[model samples]
Target: MFTIARFLTTALVAILFLATLPVHAQDAAPAEAVAAAPAPEAEAGELDGLENPNIDAATLTLRLIPLTAEELEKLSADWLAIVRASTVDVVDEQIRINNTSAELVEEAARARLTEVTESRRALFDKYSTILDAWELKGGDAAKIAGYRTYRSAIIVEETRNTDWRTLLAQATSWVVSADGGLRVATNVGIVLASFLGLLLLARLVRRTVRHWAGRIPNFSKLLVGFSALAAYWLTLAIGLMVVLAALGVNITPLFALIGGASFILAFAMQQTLGNLASGLMIMVNRPFDEGDSVDIGGVSGTVRDVSIVSTTVITPDNQIVVVPNSSVWGNVITNSTASETRRVDLMFGVSYKTPIARAQAELEKVVRSHALVLSEPEPVVRVNALTDSGVEFILRPWTKSENYWAVYWDLTREVKDALDRAGMEEVEAGAPPVVAPPTGVAAAS
Candidate 1:
């Protein structure tokens, strides 16, 4: 009876101790929970800032303007996380809408779906804002594959669910909306301003290059023209890229795409590329110019135009010949009009019985009497050789290149007439009186 009483006393004390402990612990737990939990209003405000549909792209862009690249990256990560969560919510709401049949429940699900969809759209815009900021800081586009993939997925999801009519209506509303209209107007203004600026800069560069190039004695008209045009185009190209970058457009990808395309084209257009390089060399070296009579690649004609791929030549008989620049630069180039004066050579033969001194005198007189012949370097009239036909006399006269053919033809007729009048038997009908050779130095007069 004594042992049973002791056990009951100990058990009674233990039960009393346990009952008091719960009251004290319960009191402390609420204080700790209160300290750990955030304020509901503050948490709601943070979420609303990111998910607010009222925020436009322009507004977000302005807000992000002051952030650094690292800050933008961090913010981009945050917006991506938000977008992901919103995407999940949108998916869940869509499933709920599809699974329900009750009218009120389906309507409620649709409303939730619309809300989450709008929130996701706003989240995507904010994410794009961060990406724009990052690109403006010279960030590479390839580094943001994750960001792009999610945005594209969201777009695909919306496209799959939304009807075309709803999509069109939404597009029209966005275009008419104040934010969208302002953004469009601003971009248009920037483009117009850039275009005008480019025009002005190109004009300025053209004038500057022309003026500067004109003073350089060695620069030909062709080179000067090429230089001025090249400078003008270069200025416009560089300005356009700068304006694009300033408008937050990433042009790095464009360069990469162009580089890749050029690499492939280089192989396919090997001959064209060769001509282009040869054309450049022709321009730089300036072996010939427009209107110059040239013997290039065995084609003798006046150069009409030297384009990037080929040169246009008009022959003496009015035939247009187009020769590839590669062939032109590779072959020998002979410019006939490069000199100021040319030598007109004519040879005359007389009978062996005819006096050599008299024939020489008649040839010299005919040459000197020509109006176009130069008098400074006296005419060369002498016996050059004694051929089987007769004794040969050479008549060499100098004249301006422009008057060369005129003097040549005129002297030929006059010498023949004089020889006929002199009654030389060798100057018969079958035997020719004048012989002009290619070297412009005839063995005979």
Candidate 2:
């Protein structure tokens, strides 16, 4: 416990010390500046964050002259005004000491000219630093200290130096530069070759998957389609990364940018992404396929197209309806044509006096005789309910899915006609109740 307290006390002291540092630095900065005692050459580095270039000139003045900071500031400002008012180019001109009668030799004249030229070049370079900073950084507001300066001077110098052939030759030389052609060609060729190879491989894999999927019924459509798309796109994505690496591009920043963009897009398209996810689930589960008649969300139609985001359904009237996959997956889907066979439910009524056994037999015989009805399951007819109107008998039959509607209508018409021919009464569906003679009482005389 004592050791822990000691450790805590030390930590608190460290924190307090850190918190006071910036305050002390701010307080001390002005006092140190006031002291103005120039240290060694290394101490000249203190003149930072000066916006006016004149401060830089004053700093040079301070380095050269032993003046107090106050006097230096005033003197530098005065000198800056004096320098700005006058053209300083005269300082770079050759000093012509009147040398009559071989007083100054040719060699001495050449040396003086070289010194003058060097001084002019140095002055021009110093002035160009501001312009170079702007141009190189594309007009960056912040000026960097001690950057290389040449562009502004070169541009001015070239106004009199324009020779189209010379410019073309220089540009040509740059094109064939050792760092240009070989590296770029090698990098680009590698990216292209790798991409092409990957695409071919993906295509091959897709074809292989689809080859096997073709033998299966209704199971392989979604699997094969998505697999082909995924193979190609996944290969493309991986190839893109490899291409970036080959081109000496940093992929870390690319990934970070893509991640940020993806977050925003996913959030903005939440419903769309839900639909996309639901589409994938639909494909995997094989709920319905293209060209199947389905009843989805109270809308019955033939599925014309199934895409990742939405399903297109063509209604019986040839009206096209597009539904989001999210809605389709969330609601009940009745795929009418998915199965090989379908059961047709139909109802007919008869008088209660009619023999239920005989009625049931005749109904069954009528349904079985239909060519579209399947024989394996066998048609069934039975008295399902008895109402005040009549005895309700249901006829249930199995038929090929394609023949469902046709068989239903045909059997209905044929059954009615055959029953009438047999002199049997079929109680019309939903008919009112019949009133019979009460208690068999004798009629009034």
Candidate 3:
């Protein structure tokens, strides 16, 4: 009865101590607050003004119109004033001058700085988003507005009052004007000739860039490919700009539209972009080549081709597998053919009745006699285990990676022949056999 009471008292004390102890965070079991899910990337349903019937298309302000030189100077002055007023250093100086140690005053000043920075960021985002939306979803009305407001808005629309006689006279002039037709022909010929010259120039630029990239020592595939691609695209863009200038067409809208579309598409294709980045890393690092035997991501096969987006591998069973560069880059890659020589580990067991010295000598002799095995790192033969049925021995030999399987197969047959010739009893069938389990290298590259 006394022991039982003492036990109860101990239990009571333990419970009290446990109840008073502070909580600790555990790795496996998390707090309820930690289980909160993250917010989604985008909100569901259409945006506020996008599909609203109340909002007119004309009322949407997509971009600001270009300003004249005088107007631009005044706007620059005003912008400078606003920036000076919002500068954190200036605000902090003013707060220091007030000499207020009150927490509220300090907080107010910090809050003001935050507001200024946040407002500037918000304004930049607002303009970019507006431009993107106008490029993608805006209709004919938005396009007209863009033409009218953008800098170098060169599109001109002719307007006139006309009657039947006036219209007939205009038509007659166009039909009969030989000089006007000659001028038109001349301009067309000049534009065509200029375009041909620009095409040749673009080709020259592409070749030069490719040559320069090729001259770089230890250049990666990604760098070479990107340099060529970028140079070609840049030349094309320049050529387009030249043509537009020659024809008096506006160049701003083309770039603006492309930039906006690229921005929107970037968000939509994030996974693909990630894969591309991974591919770049692979190209730069080059863990495996086109004909390498690699084991990765639970698959063992010979790599057939390594491209930007995916790597193609042919398995031993003649099956083709295409893996994304992202998966390949993010996993451990074992390349068997990476080195010129590979160590082939072999295990053999012998009957306990056999002489350990004679068996070891014979095993080493058999491996050393092999023509393909390298002598620089001599073959190793040693007792590895003493099992219930027999003594296990291991033989390690170095051979050319390409000759690994051939050497293994030959050694297996030769060792069996040599043992048979010597008439020595081998390990019993009940035991792990004299030969280890079958092992194979990757199929021919």
The prediction achieving the highest TM-score against the true structure is: 1
Error of 2 at 57 (Å): 43
Give the lowest summed-lDDT range of ten residues in model 2. 19-28
lDDT tens digits, residue span 101-214, model 1 = 544454445555655665565566577677767667755344454455556545655545543333333344444544344555676799899889899989999999999998
Pairs of residues at least 3 apart in sequence or in different chains that clash in candidate 1: 346-445, 347-444, 347-445, 393-445, 394-445, 395-445
The sequence of per-residue lDDT tens digits that candidate 2 reaches over residues 1-445 is: 7455544544443342232111101111222222224322323534333324344533452343333434333333333333333323322322232232333335455344434333333333233333232333333112211111122223233322322322233233323543333444666688889888888877887787677676677664766677667776877788788777655454655777799999999999999999999999988998888888999998899988888889899999999999999999999999999999999999899887788888887888888888899997877787777767688888889999989999999988988987788677888765544445578787557
Ranked candidates (lDDT, high to low): 1, 2, 3
> For model 3, how does the per-residue alpha-carbon lDDT over 386-432 read when each residue is reduced to its tens digit?
77778778889999999998889888877777777777666742354
Index of the highest-lDDT prediction: 1
Alpha-carbon local distance difference test for all models: 0.69, 0.60, 0.57
Which portions of model 2 show Cα errors greater than 4 Å? 1-170, 181-201, 213-220, 351-358, 387-389, 431-445
Q: What is the lDDT of residue 271 in candidate 2?
A: 100
Ordering by TM-score: 1, 2, 3
TM-score for candidate 2, residues paired by index = 0.56
Better of 1 and 3 by lDDT: 1
Query: In model 3, what lDDT does residue 257 have?
Result: 80
Give the Å shift of residue 165 in candidate 2: 9.5
